[model samples]
Target chain A: MGLAKRIIPCLDVDNGRVVKGVQFVDIRDAGDPVEIAKRYDQQGADELTFLDITATHDNRDTIVHVVEAVASQVFIPLTVGGGIRQLADIRRMLNAGADKVGINSAAISNPEFVREAAEKFGSQCIVVAIDAKRVSDQDEADKWEIFTHGGRKPTGIDAVEWAKKMVTYGGGEILLTSMDRDGTKSGFDLALTRAVSQAVNVPVIASGGVGELQDLTDGVKLGEADAVLAASIFHFGEHTVGEAKQQMARQGIEVRL
Target chain B: MRHVAVIDYGMGNLRSVSKALETVSESAEIHITSDPKHILDADHIVFPGVGAMRDCVSELRRLGLDDVIREASQTKPFLGICLGMQALLSYSEENNGVTALDIVPGQVRHFDTQRERSGNDFKVPHMGWNEVRQNISHPLWQKIDDASRFYFVHSFYVDPTDAGVIAGTSRYQHEFSAALSQENVFAVQFHPEKSQSAGLQLLKNFLNWDGQS
Candidate 1:
């Protein structure tokens, strides 16, 4: 089979509502998660990833219902993350028709969960999301650190090495998000993306800093990412999947138009 | 009233296919039914799939819609999309020690990039738009232009034993058949619903097809 380029729109659901932000600042509501998901699915989005970014403390049931509602209407793959701390959470999400479950803070807090989840539900079901921030100091040159709690805390783990380890521990895929470039509209962190892509054998989705079509092209061409994920550009009507695929085709990147 | 019963075998994308049909024929009644009687009574049938070929074929068997589909195909119109198209073939390499619907005399094989060194840069599953080149004309291609883009997401391609059934072709690293039509049977590797205007037009032609008449 040929490698398929996936175009995913990340929905940051805060308390059952979809929101978009940069560096977790200037947060603005987008729309209803179920409504937006159906619209994206109609617009030809390959997959949908829901990140419960509200720092869920007591609203787990609401998020689960949101996932269930969206899954019922949207036939495509639904991936749920955010506040996913335990195997039970993963089970709830999967039972709610989630094809995959993404774990970021939980995976870092206890890396064993990644392996255990893989063993229980199979390797192709668990995804380890790595939110990384670039360190600028010359002494810390070429270093990428993992961030937790919605990019609020640094995990002190090297992004590339952590990604390699995640795959080794049976993590299905790696979602590499560049916190520094996120919401900057500059582009994906190609350096970090390339490092992780080369370090891991599994598929890597390049997220953050996608403002223009070229950024997507760069993510696929230079970063060697399996997929290019964006929020604002797709959410705010800046570009559609058809337009993105048109641009990817111009750059010779295969995308389902 | 022309009714198109889309067999919902619980293994395919029925909504998108139904929506595409709705766009084509205003009177096209799309029923997502697993009942063999509904399929046998329908004027036409469309099988849309996305998942394992074995599971899809098995679901059709478990539901006992195989004979109904075959019977309808002999006298009415039949269209298969993606895995639905693959399911119509003899067998697939996905599930070991299994047989497919065998409606078409061919096997589905994985896209061999290593044999042909041209698709090294492009990944597998080939999810995107590639131009469809017409090899032979069928009613489905009535209004569609040559080289019109269509959406496709599949890892394997169909290799039919009967070359005359090949109706359309597309290329990634190597050229392969994209659409096939034999008698009343029509199938395409691409998703017509997701293919936009060109795809909608193809669906429209299929709705207006007077093959039986």
Candidate 2:
């Protein structure tokens, strides 16, 4: 059958607790990762992503434990990102119960690592996360530059070109996040998302700036993204995963409703 | 409690598969191991695989688990996922062609890159959730709905020489075997572990199955 569009709820965890302060019903006092993950699984989330914002050696073990605890209960594929630099780190994440590891800054520092990781672990598990922003300079009219270190440092590299190169280097999926629209609640940068999605043969997950259910639908429809990833919208309880899936399903976009 | 052993050939993600099986059944003890004896002794055997073919085949050969798997599939309730399912076929086109176990008398075929349906492009690795249509009744499918969506991330699919063994079909560029059953052995191309509720139901069914059909 035709592949269904996915609605992914991103959880940004700092240290041990969810950084966004996502509260689980009754279990709010516990703040247990497993409990929160179980809630999402029951809500019919196509997938769940855990971004360890701490990304420090001190918190790596804690995050690994979190991954293990959540993975043991949640039946969906879980992707863990942040602080993943080398093959050993990727191995640690995978062995710690992550289905896929999203690599961003490390990929920029050394693109060869992408090829190496993809070679060791299948391409299906290597996700290259690209944070991009529109370049408004006179030099380039239609250009988006890549950013690193949590969208603080801007790299002169063209976003679309880098995406194509990542695919060539064997990256299985691209998590394209529009930094300009990230927390704006305006919606996904459809132009940016569409450009990257068209450039890569692998699945593209559009992240950032999802305010409502329609934004999730737009990610698949206008942006041509295979999946949509939002943090604040899902984490803050602004909307439920079921509501997003239902909206997509009503729009004739195949979602796990 | 029933003991279920998931064969680990040092490839793919076994954590999700093992955990999902654990979540589905409280009566079954799931173990992920490469040891042949443990695999052979389990009440049920699951062969989960991913990554490249050459590496997968080589690891299976290195561990000598191929023989163990062959022996186990003949007697106990056996289940295979993705590359695990592909390895059962006679041959696979991945990695410029590699020899497989030939358990199901079939060839693993790659999706045509140039093929696209309704003008929409057909991407390889087929990574996403897709609807699976049940073609025949099987123990593993008990309590699961007819057209449930399951997560899949694979490029090549099995083309069994004997269609009678095909238990389920899913459309990508065209219809392909989503699940295959032969006697006591059942295998699927999609990751039931990542398929949510329907998947949990299928795994629960497997836990309770007697390996008769």
Measured by TM-score, the strongest candidate is 2
For candidate 2, write residues B28-120 as lDDT tens digits: 899999998899899999999878888999999999988999999899989889999999989999999999998999999988766543234
CAPRI-style grade of the A/B interface in model 1? incorrect
Residue pairs in collision within model 1: A2-B123, A2-B124, A2-B125, A3-B123, A3-B124, A3-B125, A255-B128, A256-B128
lDDT of 2 at A123: 91
| Candidate 2 structure lDDT | 0.87
Report the C-alpha lDDT of model 1 over A23-109, residue by residue, as the tens digit.
222224346777787777777777788988766588768788887777655656667887777888877887565767898888887
User: How far is A204's C-alpha from truth in model 1 (Å)?
Assistant: 4.6
Give the Å shift of residue A40 in candidate 1.
Answer: 8.0
- The per-model lDDT (C-alpha) reads 0.78, 0.87
Instruction: Give fnat for candidates 1, 2 and onward, in order.
Output: 0.04, 0.77
Number of colliding residue pairs in model 2:
2
lDDT tens per residue, model 2, A62-146: 8888998887877788899988899999998898778899999999999999999999998989999999999876565678999
DockQ of each: 0.10, 0.70
TM-score each candidate: 0.73, 0.96
Interface RMSDs of the predictions, in order, are 6.5, 1.8
